[model samples]
Target: IKYLFINHYCTLDNLFDILLYTPQLCRVNVKYLCQLHDIILNEIPIILSNLAHITIEELDLPFDVFEIFIKKMTSKLQVLSIGIISMNFTYLDVNQWEQLISQHIPYLSKFHFEHYEKMPSLSNDHHNLLKQFTTFFWIKQQWFFEIHIDTQLNGVLKKLSIPFIHIGHVLNSSILSSQGIQLVISSVDERDHDILLNDYIKSIIISTNITCLTINSSMISCVLIELLEILHNLDSLTISYSSRLLKLHGCSQQSKHHNLSTTMNITKVNMCYVTKIEQVDFILKFCPHIQYSVQMILNYHH
Candidate 1:
């Protein structure tokens, strides 16, 4: 089987037994239930050991289980998404993880991770755990095929992942390779504005191509505009605001596209609370050539 998706929680032992026979499977997505703690917490070692040699290239699993998988699994992964349960753990080993990535998973590039727990107050140790990722990427920067981070500003978890969070590229991804860089920041909060803004801009403003970008933020409009100005060849952009913060930058006369044109580079844009056509028209100015299928929020005068 080339792809397998399990929408419900299944016992790890039973899943392993099924995988053992499906040697041809290349990707698996199992929506594991947290209630199945026995499978994730207890049987991880055994589950990983049994599937050590499989060619599975992409996966989404609980954080701890995937941690074990990353260190032990022989298959080189390309894309990974992990639901982190806690940043407050005292025993998270960073050095071991660094060594594992450097040695075993050298081909891994794209990653998506977000905290699932309710606790947002990360202590110094939690920040350190997060730092491990920064360190790993920094070390592997020269070898990365391309880098991207897209963070969707969701409340509760003050996390950063988008473009880079939802998507990434390793030199050895099991799926189709992404050829360029991208950065997305959406739904960001003021609490994370200071440090994250400084850090992310400094890190990503390198000499590379950001082919696709999205900025659905108002608090960081100035920062986003400065970032857009720096990019030499941004192919597409999808930006929105709860209000008219960006649209007030005003629409451009130079941006002209046919309503039926289909060759633009921007992906789909989601806009709400838009009460005017000038607002949508102003957003389209970012990538005048973009052609998406979505009917941009049409606030026609009745």
Candidate 2:
């Protein structure tokens, strides 16, 4: 029965008992996955105890329903992945979310939550609860991960010691300056002028243990220089920018002089852009030690 579901209707809940006990079942589709989750919540206590990793997509269930399921099944769960149709969070608050996470999912090592458009707003008390969770649980854990949040969540994140990856608006300057951060991959829409004007970039450079950095093209030159100086132990760096912006900044002389003489430890540098090949060449010239390669790619005409 487990083999049948493993090979055929793996998404359905009919084989969940078999699957849960099988020890080898690691992956399941979202539609049938929830059914199995419901089964585990209702029937067997030890069914989900062996699950090492679980991922569910297209979940439209209420937050309370999901919280109950998590509290029941995630005692030994090490890796958790959830995908909602979109982040129109109307039914959950920070307290409820924090309570669910704290009571259940105590042993989780890796967690992934995806929100489509917007995240739910937590009250001040809930935010404080989140801060407590970050300090007590997230920081103490061996591995912790979260995605999708605006600058405001940085306050909570500052207390966490785990390496994290954030994919949203630039974090607050104070948050970037917090201690124990080791990696940052920022995906910012360059057209958003407000972020470029923000002081967070300088904060990132002056503080933190950031060793790996990736940024969009519109990152200001002053901030980039500051980052290069402060991230003396950086190993991998990627920078993406638009062609028109590259032209405005000029490529030739700037590229030749762009090397971080102090950051000899950097091993990889990836420069991605649309328009000016010269700018790419210039970046290559600056980082003479970095292996350079380029390919012609179509531009986004807008």
Candidate 3:
């Protein structure tokens, strides 16, 4: 297989065994890479010379264990994206990361790294952690960083459990040094979508630099209007559309107050969790210039 995607939990041994068969795999995306139980390392390395892209959504394995897996690749991987829910800050060690890339994946051209943890649990050493990423190594690679902390604002922000959001790619380097920004909002309960999104947008240093965005939060008309007003440069958007989208059926009080005269320059729109056709119609009204579109309807009761 040239491409493989694993969404469920997978142990290291299970992954190794699977890789053993897919020697010609060029790309692999694992949603969650976890260590269910301890397993002995394979004496023989499984070479994936053709594999050039690797994206691990959640790295549940420790740094050392993951290092072993990287070494086994023995290939010049061109793209590597990793998201980690770190228990130990060892993953923040810039020296180890530099050395690993230098020795193992020397030809790696693109590297996307994300670290997730409860911000409140962090000690004063959080500054030190942030400083490590600002080193010459990261700066030279144009990997600038931003830390999102969940805060209480008029009792709105406090409702969020995991408020991290990965605001996707930066289209213009001149606008922001960072090539991409990912805001991960890890939450268990339903978030106050409008207020939370507004608060998150306010935290951004340069919101205009963010050309593409994915809103996993529950969709609402006020939130959509707020996004249109604030994100003036947004070119593409991905959002959920359900019964809440029906809220925009008529000119609501919020829509009446806001000026909808400014036409959005957005060219692409992707909708998920769509429950009705009217939801699509509502979006089209706001984004008149959408050149490309995609919608996913999970359950069609309409």
Best-matching candidate per lDDT: 3
Off by over 4 Å in 3: 150-158, 161-173, 177-302
- Would you estimate the TM-scores of all the predictions? 0.43, 0.44, 0.55
lDDT of each: 0.46, 0.45, 0.62
Task: Give the distance in Å from residue 263's predicted Cα in candidate 1 to where it truly belongs.
Answer: 41
Question: Which residue pairs clash in candidate 2?
Answer: 11-32, 217-240, 217-241
**Positional deviation of 178 in candidate 2, in angstroms?**
7.9
- Residue 39 error, candidate 3, Å: 3.0
State, as a TM-score between 0 and 1, how close model 1 is to the true structure.
0.43
- Considering every candidate listed, which one attains the maximal TM-score? 3
- Lowest summed-lDDT stretch of 10 residues in model 3? 166-175
Query: How far is 221's C-alpha from truth in model 3 (Å)?
Result: 24
Name the runs in model 1 displaced over 4 angstroms: 33-65, 70-73, 85-93, 116-119, 136-185, 188-215, 219-242, 246-302
Q: Roughly what TM-score does model 3 have, to 2 decimal places?
A: 0.55
Cα RMSD (Å) per model? 10.4, 10.7, 8.9
Q: Which stretches of candidate 2 lie over 4 Å from their true place?
A: 1-27, 31-46, 72-75, 85-102, 118-133, 142-213, 218-302
| lDDT tens digits, residue span 183-244, model 3 | 32222123545444544345452432445555544445665576556655666666665434
